[model samples]
Each structure stands twice: as structure tokens, then as C-alpha cells.
Target chain A: MSVKHALLALLEQEPMYGYQLRAEFEQRTGTTWPLNVGQVYTTLSRLERDGLAQGGGEDTEGHVIYRITDAGRDEVATWFTTPVARTQPPRDELAIKLALAVTVPGVDVATVIQQQRSATMAALQDYTRLKRQATGTARAELAWSLVLDSLVFAAEAEVRWLDHCEARLRRAAAELDVQNSRLTDGTSSVKREFRRSTGETHADRTRR
Target chain B: MTAVLQLTDVVRVHGEAPHEVQALRGVSFAAYAGELVAVMGPSGSGKSTLLTIAGGLDQPTSGAVTVEGVDLARLGQPERARMRRTSIGYVFQGFNLIPALTAAENVALPRELDGVAPRQARAEARQALEEVGIPHLADRFPDDMSGGQQQRVAIARAVVAERRLILADEPTGALDTETGEEILRLLRARCDAGAAGVLVTHEARHAAWADRVVFLRDGVVVDETGADRAETLTEPAAR
Candidate 1:
């Protein structure tokens, strides 16, 4: 998410050309977040404009290398020590979909939740398989495994949320049934009505 | 590689007429040697029904289930029971170890039941306990061991006779997260050691250890995906 800081941190190691920087970033991150060479060059130019990095003279091979400036080193140090801000969480499309599905009419909310749950489950499985395959002792493997685990945790959370949504919807429907029966009978026996109609308690409904 | 277990258009129904519950509706599946396939679904989605039919503990109302190329429904009840003891291994959530039996005896029970000599059965059981990384627990009774240790003993029982097909239903339902992971690792190891395994689980994390995942809903196969393509299936669509 913080490509600028990541590039700065990488530059602190040694001077690198655009291609070399991209390759090194990918190697360390296990290609989980691939860096385009063009993106690297563009960032390098911006760092030069901001005086955070300076381009050294071309080598004998005609490749221009960039080195971190004092400003870039200080920025990288701050980035490492500072906690990542959560005040403005990134927009999650699944969260948005579920939120809208509950309020939107004729949306078939159950189907929406089920589809998203299936997708998230598939992704979780993929992450676990990748984790198993990444058994190398290299530092890159460790980094990649950590990244994959975060994704797995996120997907697992999404699936659990979907299940919660389904249970909530079922409860809402059961409550609506109780409200209807109460209005007809002029009796406030919501629990008894729910049981009479569904032949099961709220706990049974949620367990199903 | 050949499939150690195959279900072809299997259909199972409980009760009759208006009260009939169609537990599995024309579901087909296969688990190959050296592969772990996970079956996942909500409750009443036929996961347990599928497992029971595959293990030949129950018969299908329609279609066929084959283990090692032999149709299960074709065999008599006694023959099917024998096949279950010799070719199929089942693990349940309860650990299911006999209270009076030691870990090694529990693991060796299946072999001994199949008329195998007691000494040979005990030797196989010790080897299995060693494979599960708990040989020292062989002499300990189930009550003396931890939940994880008991599960390991159950796994040893499952794989003791070199059974090619292992069916597990919520095998880690009773253990903590770390212990559940250890159990999954053991199941994965068994599959890697050239056995076919089918794991029925509600948790996606448990299903993640599988090579292929099959999703069931309303007693029908809804989706199937290989582990590598899971990301593409879950990725958000273009806004």
C-alpha cells in the first residue's frame, strides 16, 4: 500500500537501476506485490524531484542508478517506526455489497451472501495451499508466507461475516413472522408463535 | 493415478413419500491416491451422508460408489463391513477410542478385528503411532492423554492397516486451533504418503489444507475448484 516508502526502504540497501529495483523488490516480497519497472522509474523520478533520491551517473553499461538521500533515509526510518494508520480503512467491496444487499429491495440477499462466502472460502483454500508450497528457508519465503497468512485471515473473516449475515437474516424473518402473528391474534406471545410456526427455536434456526 | 474412491451419480434419500429427505441428489465425486479432497457445506447439505455412502456404511438409493474399482452396493453387508475394515478408515469428531484400551490397542483394534494376528497388529499399531509422532503415548490410555494426543491415536487407527481411503467428518471439531492444525498436518501427510482422503469440514481454514474443494448445497455439488485457482474465484469483480 505504501509503495513510496517501500521503494525508499529498498534504496537504503544499495544504489539500483529501475530494473534492478523492481527485481529486488519482487524477490524480497515473493512477487506477492509485483512492482512494475515503469512504476519504479516513475517513483524514482518523483523522489529525485523531491530531493529524497538522486540519480548517480550512468555506469559503463549505460544504466542509470539511483541512491537514497539523507531525506529518504529519514523517511524510511519513520515509516518503519510508525504504526500503520487505520482511521481511513480502505474500501472493501464485499463489505459494501453486504451492506447494500440488506437494505436493497428484491436483492436476494441470501444468494449474495452465499456467493461471496463461496468465493472467500476458495481464496482461503488457495492461500493455505500456497503456504504449504512455500517451504523454502529463504527470507523471501518468510515474507511471502506472512503476506499469504494475512490474506487467509481476511478471507476467513469474510466467510464468518457472511455466515453471521445469514443467521441474522433468518432471525429477522422469524421475528417478522412473530410480529405478523401477534398483530392477528392481539397476543404478545412472540416466542410461542415463533415456535408454533417454525417448530424450532431460534437456536435451532441459527444452527441450521 | 487411479482414484481410490469414486462416487458416481450417487443419490441417498431418507424416509418415503412426502416425508422423504433427499440427502444427496445425483452427486458425483472422486478422491485419488495421494490427494486430499475436502467437502464443505452448510448443515443438511449432505456432507455426512456422502461420507457414509463412500465408506460403504450406508447404501445409495441410486447410482454407485466404488472403492478400489469395486462397487460398494454390489457387495453384501458382511463383505462391505470387511471392506470398511480393510480398505477404508474413518475418523470421527469424538476421538472414539475405547476407554479400556491403550493407545496402541486402540490403533490396533481394526486390524485385530479383521482376523490379523495380535502380534502383527500391535507391531503395525506401534509403527502407526510412531508415524503420528507419538510413539511414547502408545502405552497411555485415552483418558491419560490430551485431546490432541487422543486425536493422533484415532489417526493412527485410521492409517494402521495401510487403508487407502480415509474419510474424516469434522475430525478437529473438539480440539483447539493449534491442535486442529496438527491434526490437519497429519491428514495431509497421509495423503502425501499415497492415500486418498476425504475430509468433511465446515471451516474454510480446515478445507484449505485440501488439494481440491467441493462445495455442496441442498444435496447437490454447486462448485468445485482446484487450490491454485481459488484466488480468481474469490476476487472482487470490476466495479
Candidate 2:
């Protein structure tokens, strides 16, 4: 999740050309983090300027390669062992929905989940149609194809997960019990059943 | 209390036909080992229904329920009755200590009801008082002590039998904030002692002390998780 550290970590493995590094970054972690050769060069340039890394001159093709310095090694070691706590931006979309759901008559949580699920499913259908239309035989086309597959799979999974979530929420919503025990006999119920076996009446079983 | 004994989906309906009101629909929540869970909801939201059903003081209108893994709904009426007597310790909103009994005697009542030897019950009651940090109040009557002290005595009483499940329906509702916190501390200690408990509270402050907080509405649990689901759990509950 930490992009800077992840790049630095990859660079520590061995000397790599900017293009090679970019490609490897994607191949390794399913790089949702977009990696560009220019970004790799900029980072390597910064690392060389900081003395935490150095350019290994150039290959016969004139592409510069990078190697880590002692300081860079220490930074990568620290990065690997020390966890960076994730700070997600506060998102209260669900909470807002729940709060509003309570205010509207007949708009319980089951209906809410159902509505969300429907929209997500619709989006999945759209994504599937788009995926089917994407074609061609270029490298970019292959990459686009993979991205489309990921998108469609993720959407379908979200729709399925939402369905399961809604079912569980509905099951929980259906089981709210209320406590009220009083009858014409004035015996009350619940505890009265316990009191009855001993022939105790309401007056006799009155708790202090 | 340490952990929840068990709970099943509990639903209850009031009245009949179109006039019928569903108190609880299908509420199911659990208190964990050494966990002090608080169930909070506005009036008419089935808070009491959850505590009572889970405590086995009443059967759910429909659904399975278990206390300490013993199914309350499946047991014969008499066995379920005995389970209530032996496995559950209840502290109601009312102090409800016997007017004539001293604090120690009130604390010992559960054991006495179970036919525990009087001397043994007295010793156990004194120890429970000490556990709740109020052994000095053993001789005092409920009226003699402050409301806070009375609740401590109530907690001592509730745990005297070492019931695995201590179901307190608004145990501190009648007390002021300071006293309420002291009572919460005592309940926390009970959980440390390996008794799992459920505390019903309207106050968010009280509910946050629980390892988990369960929010109910319309006789159902709407949200439940660590007291702080989106933020740090250490943030204290607002009074």
C-alpha cells in the first residue's frame, strides 16, 4: 500500500533500468500503482542525488541502471520491518444511509441493501458489456483486457458480497424482541411462570 | 463478565393480527470471554427483550436461544427454570434488594435460594462484596448506603453464585455519572474474573466501555462491533 517504499524495495533487489523496473513493479504486485519509466527515472535521479543510491553508469544501449547505497539499504530495511498504519479517509456513506433509512417510513435496512445491490449489479452488467466490446491484438489491448477482467470480476464479487451482507442484516433485523409482561390476572408473565410452579401469586412474588 | 454464554435469534410479537406489534424480530448478539457487552437502544427498541431473552428469564416468541451453550428454548420448562436460577445473575434497573435484609444477606440470597448452607453463603457473600470493593458495606442495609454503593452491593449479589452470565438491565441507569462509572468498573472486574455479562444502557458513555457495543432498534440489532469500528477503540465513550 505504501508506494514509495514499495518502489525503493524493488530497486534494492539489483541494478535495474527504468523501463525494466516499471515492468517488474507491475509483474510483481499486480501493480495497481501506476509505474511510468519517467517516474522511475525521477525517483532514481532523486535517490542518486540523495546519495542513497547511484547510477551504475549505463548499459551498451545507454539506459542508466541504479544500485542502492548503504543509506538506501537501511531505509529499505526500516521500510520492510516497520509497518505504515493505513489512514483511510473517513467515509460515512453507509452511516448516512442508515441514519436516513431510519427516518423514512418503510425504508428499513433490507431495502437499503437491496437498492445498493441492484445498482452494483447494474454496473457489473455495464462493465461486462464493455469488457466484451474491448478487442484487438496489441500489447495495450492485452493490458486493457486484463484490466477489464479485473474490473468485471471485482464488480461481480461486490454484487455477490452485497447480497450475502443483505441477507445477514435482514436475518438480524427480523429478531428484535420486546419485553412486556402483564395480563388481566395481574400475575404478569415471564418470571411469573417461574413463580407459578411454587404456587406464588403476583402479590406473593412481588420483587423487593 | 468474561464471555457470553450463548444467544440465539430471539423474536417476540405483541398483540395479534393487524394490531400485532413485533417487539423483537430476530435479534442475535454475543458477549465474548471476559467481555462486558452493552446493548443500547431507545425506549420501545427491544433492549429489555434482548436482556431478558438472553438471560433466560423469558422464552423468545420464536427462535432458538442458549445460555452458556444450554438451549433455553429447547429445554423442558422446568429445566429452563432451573437454568435461570443457577446460571444467570440479574441486576435490574431497580436495586430491588430485600428491604429488611442487610447488604450481605441480599447478596447471599441467590445462594440461599439454591439451598447453599447459610454459613457458606455468608462467607461467599462477604467474598463477593470484597470482590466488588465494598466488603465494608456488608452489614449496611440498601437504604443505609448511597445508590452507588447499593448497586455495588447488587453487583456483588449478582456474582455471588459466580453465574457465568450477569445480565444487568440498566444497572447504572439510576445513578449519576461518577457512580455509574464506579459501577462499570465493578462490572469490568467481574468480566476479568471470567464472568461474561450484558449491560443494557442508553448512555453511549456506558456502552463504549464494553469490548463491543450492540445498537438495537425496532427489536433488532442494527450495528455491532468493537466500540470504535472506524476509529481507535481507546477513545472513551462520551457521557
Against the unseen true structure, what C-alpha lDDT does each candidate score? 0.88, 0.73
Report the C-alpha lDDT of model 1 over B1-239, residue by residue, as the tens digit. 34689899999999999799999999999888888899988898999999999999889999999999998888888899999999999999999999899999999999999999999999999999999999999999999999999999999999997999999999999999879988999999999998999999988889889888898877999877674433332342552
| Clash pairs for candidate 1 | none
How many clashing pairs per prediction, in order? Answer: 0, 23
Q: Which candidate is the best by lDDT?
A: 1
Interface RMSD, one decimal, each candidate:
1.8, 16.5
- How far does residue B182 in candidate 1 sit from its true spot (Å)? 4.3
RMSD of 1: 7.5
- Which whole-number lDDT from 0 to 100 does residue A169 have in model 2? 61
Which regions of candidate 2 fall more than 4 Å away from where they truly are? A1-208, B1-3, B227-239
The CAPRI class of candidate 1 is: acceptable
